[model samples]
Target chain A: MAEVRVAVPPTARKGEVIEIKTLVSHPMDNGFLLDYGGRMIPRWIINRFEVEYNGEMVFSADWHVSISTNPYLIFYTVATETGQLDFKWYDDNGEIYTHTAEITVT
Target chain B: MTQKSTRRDVLKLAGAATAATVAPTIATAQSAGGVVVIGAGFGGATAARYLRRAGVSVTLVEQNSSFSTCPFSNTVLGGINNFSSITHGFGGLRREGVNVVRGRVNAVDPDAKSITLDGGDTIAYDRLIMSPGIDFKWDAIEGYDEAAAELMPHAWKAGSQTNILRRQLEAMPDGGVVAIAPPGNPFRCPPGPYERASLIAHYLKTEKPRSKVLILDAKDSFSKQGLFQAGWAELYGDLIEWVPFSEGGNVARVDPATNTIFTDFDEHKVDVANIIPPQRSNRLVDTAGLADGGDWCPINQTTFESTIHANIHVLGDASIAGRMPKSGFSANSQAKVCAAAVAALLAGNDPASPSFINTCYSLVAPDYGISVAAIYRIIEDGTIAPVAGAGGVSPSDAPASTRALEADYARGWYASITADMFG
Candidate 1:
């Protein structure tokens, strides 16, 4: 499974466009290269990524093989209320790697 | 069977790098020693079981109660297996006298001989056995980061991504391209990517005969190359295409927007992909200063003890074990060697100079398999080198019966290794 990390302000004003930065710990094995001995290393990369705010989808991406390992993303979302922001990375292999952060909105 | 390998010849390596760690005191040497083992995978779990059985008080610390294994995971990628079979629990190890604890090991303080858990509890040990295994070098590949893992599956660790790749294969349109990107040297299971390609191709051949599996390799050669290629030719025919680095196999970047991988030679569009990036020792292992700013921890191959630290031993993929592939069997073998040393060290006895062995079996299909095995011992140069002519790979032209038998051995090895570790 991938390790997803998120950085968000502890407090945000209602209706603020909060900047959310996230990082995931993954090799993103780009099933393209060979080992030192010249064999095709198997590819097992994450292919879909998504983020949600309080159960509402805010962003999603259809990813392929070319992405950074432990890929990081920064995006802006409106802080409408005190709720949890969920971040998820979907693996081509069929699992979802997720992380969440709680934001206190005034 | 070498004429020159006398006892003196073998012991020369021992003299070259003799470990200074022995029972510090005679009176306390015979007492039951405390050992804290971290990570309940092949290396840690096996060491915990063996050390506890050797009359040492062992604390097996793991973050999860259940452990999914990587040895048999290619079957999952082939679409013929599931997680339940490859995953296991620690009940057997606990019942066998190891004090198995489910907690995150937050920190390992070598000087204090103690480990702090996430909840603030601490467990001290006479010796620490760290089998934290390999972690990806996050930026080894351009655009291949953790966030992109969800976008590209590196099902190397044998967890959720195992099934993810299968689902992707299932969802791919018939005749769609399935591209696999394997990691480079010193990674786990050197022959894994080829085996994966073979098995996935089997799935495609059966489920979607028009589909194809493309392997983009970082290296020009691989372990059991003749065997894997032969298997591919015999079984998969023209369905599998392999591009080596000399021929533009290396991917330069990945763009999820188009589900495409750009290689030095050309850009590949695929319906699904497995992008395995570069790897190194786990982050925590390096954080503990065990790796000493290097990609892998340097250890005395004779005792598997960190040359840079005391009262600590590293096993499996984390250690710089020369000539041994980073595989589960190697970890288990290394764990046994480490367990003996830890037990002997605490008991105030001289640890034995141990021999290491590894045999990795990969299935090209359910009833067909290939293997590479080696017997290793420390050499006069103070390295863990393979014993000359001790083992070899399955014959590329071996009869079907031999391949079938290797397949059975693969299953047997999985069952036995899991039992040896967890129990």
Candidate 2:
């Protein structure tokens, strides 16, 4: 589980390619380290990161253990209308962390 | 930035005050030497106020526009205290006649007795005080860096990180496991992590119901452990699980890419992880050459003068204080002691023998609280030794009324200490 923060222009002109940024708090434990007893640390990283705008897939990435904790992602998307930008992070634990940011377009 | 007063104005005010009271050690009949204090946290602010009252020309420099206290920040995570309640401004110190400068002091030139600001401004002083507090030893914890902190928030600094951790806890679903990895000894607030678990469990018990708190401690035991255990048993039951160092509680490493915590024997994949790294004196000590080959500065127990630097004092978390636990109360007490010593030293007299007191109260639940208090003395050998049997913690399973009373006391202590530092 993580707290999600997103940055998007509050208002945009139609067809503008606006930059969208997102951040989430997580450990992204890659299962490489040892536990207190010298056992291997089981990995549980966010394996998939995706973003959608107005029912269209705007951005996506297949992440690995290299993706640090509190994953941050940024991409460009055309402002076609006033709609919500949806974000979902899929982890090896089968947990889905979701967030949404609304954009207003004139 | 607040307007700076001329040295003459300070001397004039000091002269007027001295005429009414017994003259303190004075570099002049009108005023004492100028003292420059760095990092206006509890220690610096308290020293500034007391020095100004003692008629010493003083300037307090701080990098932050406002201070966010770590003492009661856990309450913000529990929704028991508002974020603004723990944040303070420097307007109070300025009004009290302390020249409060807002800037990042970049260097301390010991021989010259001066400090340099980032923009090339230099401040000269006869005596200087630094209480820059602690910094994270990022290398000690593998894969945990400043950027990774955004992913695995420590919330140790009590600002943006605290907010981030709180939001993570709030966003966690029912039946989720919230994990905490508390750093080893010599860190700030000896009993903080447990208090956080207690309050977080209280919040979860009410809201999430099925959630649990897993505490992985670096030590085998902790301050007030018995009382905390008793309270958890009586209130939270199985909602809290503790793993001590003896049983693989020590965190060997953390991976942010997976939100995983690794111990020597086992690995935990948690829903939310709070990783607090080992600490050292703030990096400012390195630039000042004050930390004599250690992570913390060594100070004269009697006067808090840094052993490596003459005419300079270090107080609070950045210095080694034998038996004192790093808490807001401890810092406030040290600052007052340091202020008095600085005044006496400037006035051409040795400082009076120092005695200090610290009381830390923790809330286990909104209505349940416990406390620990200690009295310290600078013995003949100059070690800050706690008076034998002079301090104790609240009794386990105290009556509900007593717990509630202690909760009230916790609130009162917060108000009183903030007043002492910033009022």
Candidate 3:
């Protein structure tokens, strides 16, 4: 599993539609306690995520246990203004992980 | 007799003048009846002062003779301030003509409008204000109670326990672990445990680099998450370990004998343990038949009058102030609104629409601070909601100078709150 990285278009004209990419570092281990050598290993996984811009929802997705470790997601949205882009990831256990990046449109 | 006044007539005039001088004093004492206020901390002290300013006599009943604040207690842990700096005398309140009574209230009778002191004396009041703050739910954490606090200090209420925790931190050997067990939701000062971790980590980085501060949080995320994470990353990234509730951080029990905290799956033995237990309204509120459920007294949002009883107002941590975090600032704000309503009722005037403001500041390091502020107004539905676009967390990517200014603002906020409440 690699670390999560999120990137948006480095430069975009004002009001231009651009792509935003996000990748997270996690092993989406589903809760299936499997015994290896008579030892139980509890499962853990990232379940869902959403993207918002300036307090408005832009894109979202739901994931399952089978979505491989450190899932990367990408989406497109029109840059309307200079504001914040927020990303939130939730694990199967309802643990929420959030990150935000700034976008300035010239 | 007209030309030369008789001595008897002159004496009669003197007697009338003396009676006139004494009449207003007796009348004021009768009309300006004193309110018996329990708890002389932030909320009670503020209410007493404001009531006195409104020409209402006040008798402040406090268990302690002096006041010691929990606000900025993290500074004491960080060695920035001592207990003396936070300690204040009640002389200022006394100078305002408030009768400062030092005794524990045994019982409160709403019907009788009186409070029974532990010394077998009863004080009657036209109105009673109770702000006894929080009492720990000792049973929530097994093997932990008032007796255990001497060794395993919670330090949540601040004073001696705070000093004890600071001393323990100083006494720990290098590379030792300082475990801080934060309670669940509905605790006083939601951001408090995190701030304590930051300040302790600050102390360790300079004095004992090899030492570590472990935060065993019962919740997932806390106030000002981004700012705290940024400070941790910049200052002591690896030295501080925060284990959330999903992990093995949820503490269920503690054995004070061995200085060990027991979670569901593991036992953590630490050099020092600051266990902030689950909290509820003080015992008086519960015993007075005021608490509705969840160990807090429910009240009407507008007047802060108890939902169970009429003409009895409950403010501060004892009241279930909806949508407001249990903080000193929130308590102080609510007390002012409550005071206004009480005064309006006394004057036979309708209470005005009430509003409140709260801004909580947390110092992540000596030079780094963060805050969350909100302005709240009572809606037509009688519930308080944050005024939109009024307040929020500090921007995440703010510059170093902004962070430094935030530190100064944090100090200023403390001074302002204390002044508003006590000064």
The two-chain DockQ for each candidate, comma-separated, is: 0.02, 0.01, 0.02
Candidate rank order under DockQ:
3, 1, 2
Compose the digit string of candidate 2's lDDT tens values, residues B303-358: 89999999889999998876888887888999999998988888777799889998
Error of 2 at B70 (Å): 0.4
Score each candidate by Cα lDDT: 0.84, 0.86, 0.82
How would you encode candidate 1's per-residue C-alpha lDDT over A13-80 as one tens digit per residue?
Answer: 99999877666667778999888999987898888888888999988887667876656566789999
TM-score of chain A of 1: 0.91
TM-score of each: 0.75, 0.76, 0.75
Q: What local lDDT score does residue B82 receive in model 2, on the 0 to 100 scale? A: 84
Worst 10 residues of 2 chain B by lDDT: B24-33
The residue pairs found clashing in candidate 3 are none
Superposed by TM-score, candidate 2 places the C-alpha of residue B398 at a distance from the truth, in angstroms, of 2.2
Q: What lDDT tens digits, residue by residue, belong to model 1 across residues B182-240?
A: 86686988989998999999999998999988998877688889888889999999999
DockQ for candidate 1, C-alpha atoms: 0.02
Q: Considering lDDT, where higher is better, how would the candidates rank from best to worst?
A: 2, 1, 3
TM-score for candidate 1, please give it. 0.75
- Writing each residue's lDDT as its tens digit, candidate 3 over B1-423 gives 366788998899878886664454334434746566789887898888777655567788998878888889999999888888877778888888778899999898888888899988998887788888899999998999998888899998878899899999999999999999999888889999989999999999989999988888777678887789888999798888998754546787899999998764467998898999999998888657889756888988877888887666788877888778888898888888877677666655677888898889899897898889999887666787788888999988888898899999999988887877676
